[model samples]
Target: MPRAIGPVLVEGPVEVVLPDGTVVVSERPVVALCLCRRSRRYPFCDTSHRRRSRPSVERPADGEQA
Candidate 1:
């Protein structure tokens, strides 16, 4: 199933065929397929999509120590 911010869970030992005619296989009993396309390991989920950017903290000037 697809989640709002996660991968699609699938029963594994599955073979994925990419658009480029490349085939990838996984033999795990379960698999997480990347839906966000942000996975370092494409076609598989590495939880990369869950990462959120943090706001930058303001730093004091060099002469003025915090």
Candidate 2:
């Protein structure tokens, strides 16, 4: 199922078959699969989705003024 702030959840131990036929196995009681594709650990959630992108802060050039 989808979560409001995280990856989709599924019961384990699960054997996930990738598009390329690569199989991934997890022995945990529960698994969190990444849907946003932002996780460094593909097919598994590493809590990367919880991290918000930081906006660039524009500072005054050469500190002329704030």
The per-model lDDT (C-alpha) reads 0.92, 0.90
lDDT of 2: 0.90
- TM per candidate comes to 0.75, 0.71
After TM-score superposition, the amount by which residue 52's alpha carbon in candidate 2 deviates from its true location, in angstroms, is 1.5
For model 1, residues 1-66, the per-residue Cα lDDT tens digits are 745688889998999999999999999999999989999999999999989899898899889877
Clashes of each: 0, 0
Model 1 poorest ten-residue lDDT run: 1-10
- lDDT of candidate 1 vs native? 0.92
User: What is the overall TM-score of model 2 with all chains considered together?
Assistant: 0.71
Query: Best candidate per TM-score, number?
Result: 1
> For residues 1-66, what per-residue lDDT tens digits would candidate 2 score against the true structure?
755567889999999999999999999999999987889998999999989978989899995887
Worst 10-residue stretch by lDDT in candidate 2?
1-10
What stretches of model 1 exceed 4 Å from their correct place?
1-4, 56-66
Please give the distance, in angstroms, between residue 58's alpha carbon in candidate 2 and its true position after superposition.
Answer: 7.2
